[model samples]
Target: MSQSRILVTGGSGRLGQMVLDQLLHAGVSGIITTTRTPDKLGAYASLGVDLRHADLNDPQTLSKAFQGADRLLLISTDDLFSGRRVQQHTNAIDAAKRAGVRHIHYTSMPEPEASTAIPFSSDHVATEATIRESDLSYTILRVAWYAENPVELGLIPAALRTGTWLTSAGAGRIAYVTRSDVARAAAAALVRDKETSQIYDITGPHAMSAAELAAALSRSVDRPIEVRQVDDTALARELVASGVSPQLAPMLVTTDANTRAGNFERVSHAVQELTGVPPTSFESFLVKNKARLLGATDK
Candidate 1:
């Protein structure tokens, strides 16, 4: 449904920035973005996008920022170490409800229950429950693993540097979709007139296993990546040994475990259905990011 305004939480992050771009490109009007650091969104403001200072961490600030918004896009929080991811999401959902948002769109994962390995996944499950419990119109975009995860999570760089790709996800395939494709899907859902309660599994066109990922990266970066399959514990230790924070290591470990269990094996056409654009392939993402991936390894 068309609305007077739409609000996006966590607007300063990478995915949020891309979602804002998609919304602007779609000619979406009355866009409001919330971030703890509003000054960081000056560029968005320059483009006539409404910017507001609202920290999901601080529920008090959200009331004002969430007000005047007819629709809302609740981006899941990434505050893994804080032990407050669920509470933060709850705060945003409550604020949106009180602000009288008619419809809500959320960026979730492919299977909420399948994220048992991922400790932070509770936040997504909890937020979805809260949104549904509120009896508001909602669309949950179950965004699959990002195609850029290897680079985003430092796996690509580390692999390139060490010539080894370590994983616990043996023969498990993940339908990794690009962040931009997920953003486009979110933007499309935000502006659509549908008020139905629904969920869309936003995934890439194809699924690939860890070994296949290594091969793709090898070709893209023109380097040999030796795939080493290890248990979850060993994977965690390796990540920590490679400079990953001790706290973040566990979450990474569980992500692989979840994949190994086939939790992320679902490949859906929801991205194209929602955005009217084909989801970018993981191979294409690697090719496009070849330069940046190599540069990160050098660092």
Candidate 2:
């Protein structure tokens, strides 16, 4: 039998919703999900999910939400761009420890210290360390690139439309895992009894570069799209001009450099091994989201 009760925090988030759905699909009956705004979680409510009101920033609220839960899915807080996000994560971890949760499942970045040089990566890296050091059984699900990342929908499509894909990730490949795949892996880990201190680098099968992705989009949309390698200085300028934080400009540049350096270059079999199904491939991802992505190509 699964845990008596499985509690998922941030259940309303994109990945969180998928995790919740997969857990229900897996026949886990006693599922408890927490959201800051319970009223907004109408769909989950209709599914007979016990909704608890709790903000990740407040340990008292988290403790109440986590009580009586044998398993806890600590969906990483979405306030990465905010200044207080790290503190918010600390508060949630503290509450999990206080509640004596049996297993703490964390949704973390894949090589947060190395990927895309985003500021959030540092936060995830620190959180992973905190989870490891804490006196609790933990499963670290280090997620690789999410195929549905905004870059896929926004910048990539925009670049395709203009017939110009500009980035410093020249020929660098990444195993872009889907949100569903990551969710499935996390849900699978939650239901299983594994030794503590287990770390799984969840990734997809294929590793494609920006140029290759551009080619895929071109084929999908029936257009000629070209990938242009922009220098770090130009990349920083473009990001800043696009209203991206000046503070984060350097981070993006660093990330592009890391990509070129082949940081996110590995494909992991963890997903297939854990879920008994291969993780979604980048081509499959492009096919499914072809509408959303190609929709932008029309404009």
Candidate 3:
């Protein structure tokens, strides 16, 4: 199959780095990767990747960096609290247009417009609009909550220590997809010979509630973890008291609120359809990371 120069923005990021690896594993060449710090991607450069320095905050950099790229993967920016994420995204979209990039790919969350809890959801809503309004052939991957979110945030560790899994989701369920799986699906979309305007909701096979997830955590860590549900306000208060920063506590609380609103309760075949392989189960993901979550084990 012929290859076009596929440019992956934020190539040094967690998801973007994984997408680059998947692209290489697929033997897809003519790859262009952009990050703010090009020196950090020495390994990818060694693999014949065209590394460029691009910053979403700087439109001129992006315009120059995206040159000659047929496809572009705009991994959503990570400025959760800055409130400038949408503007940053717009800069990239405009840069892609200036560079004349044909197809654009985006990573987004599910039901952003319906998300009353997450203030950042509007950022995605605007980004999607900008992408569509650009008239570029695009693929939007509405990725679900990452299974690693609990672990990446301080939640899993706190729960394991206190034997109390705290949440404000009530009975809300979410299909938490893994980061690698999301990355694979995004990569698969970019490399396809038939690119078109499409949106795919990438989710795990099963929708699980906080209790179910707590049970999984209990089993993984070999401990009894009891789910402790509270109101969103109370949860935020407790989170801040437990050492979470005031800035981030609200965002964490709202994830549960959004879940309660049924924004994330979904199960889809998009991952399997895109990658030709069923996404890994949540149980499998926990088992694989149990060691890390558990920290040191008995020798």
Candidate 4:
């Protein structure tokens, strides 16, 4: 059989870059990647990845970018809380079908069909349904929360400053995996020859509650932190007061609701199964990024 030509969308983004690197490390050639700003991906172009300009919102660019691709990685966009994201995803899927892409791998959130508590779940659910209804073979990778997201989201710093982390997700457990692990899994799925449609819930090894997460942060930063439970409305109000975008506050608030409902508590070995390595743990991630988390200039 001929080798597959892989096309990865959003190749300059965090997760997409990692996936591209892993595919290269696995010795897979004929790789293609798409980005709106191709100049930003000079490193990838140097590595022989066919870097093409494609915008999910612009269907005109997708078909050409997807040409000759045996598999396509439809990395979901980061435009949360906007209704346009779903439409953009649908456009990509339609274009991939038109381009004769055989298999499509999509990065999606866990239990999108059942996790109504998360405002963005409907978008992923809709996208997944579209991929399923199409003629292409598909792999649905339902990713868990990123272990580093708490620091990036300002949750850890907020807990450090206030000595309390207010949350609506009371006693909710999350199996937070890393973006690197998810990317590796995506690369593995792309290289493997799977004849049938598949769905994998890629997650960390274990689940922990908000209190546990706070304790882990405290240990990493060497500062005391506390978890304070609050209602969704209160959390949303606090987030807005803290300068979070008013449009995004509600979605964050509902994420807590979803967590509290155990929607994110599932732990899976999909990462290990796919990449042959266990996913990174939350504590290890915190320890590795302690300096950055503590506001230090260097590690």
TM-score of each: 0.94, 0.90, 0.95, 0.93
**Candidate 1 lDDT by residue in tens digits, 1-299:** 47658888889999999999998888877899998888999999999988898888888998888889988999887887588888888888888889999888888887887677776677788888988998889999888988877676777777888888888999888899988898888988888887899999999998889899889888988889989999998998997777566765676677788899899889988888887779998888999988898888787
Sort by TM-score, best first: what order?
3, 1, 4, 2
lDDT of 2 by residue, 65-107 (tens): 8888888888888686777777877787788778877778888
Candidate 3 accuracy as TM-score = 0.95
> What ranges in model 4 sit over 4 Å off?
239-251, 296-299
Return the number of clashes found in candidate 4.
0
**Model 3, range 9-84, lDDT digits (tens) per residue?**
9999999899999999999998999999999999999999999998888887887899999899999989877888
Instruction: Give each prediction's root-mean-square deviation over alpha carbons.
Output: 1.8, 2.6, 2.0, 2.3
All candidates' lDDT scores?
0.85, 0.78, 0.88, 0.86
| Structure candidate 2, residue pairs in collision | 116-255
Worst 10-residue lDDT window, candidate 1 = 243-252
By descending lDDT, how would the candidates be arranged?
Answer: 3, 4, 1, 2
Which runs in model 1 stand beyond 4 Å of their true positions? Answer: 1-3, 240-248
Regarding TM-score, does 1 or 3 come out ahead? 3
Better of 3 and 4 by lDDT: 3
Please give the lDDT score at residue 29 for candidate 2.
80
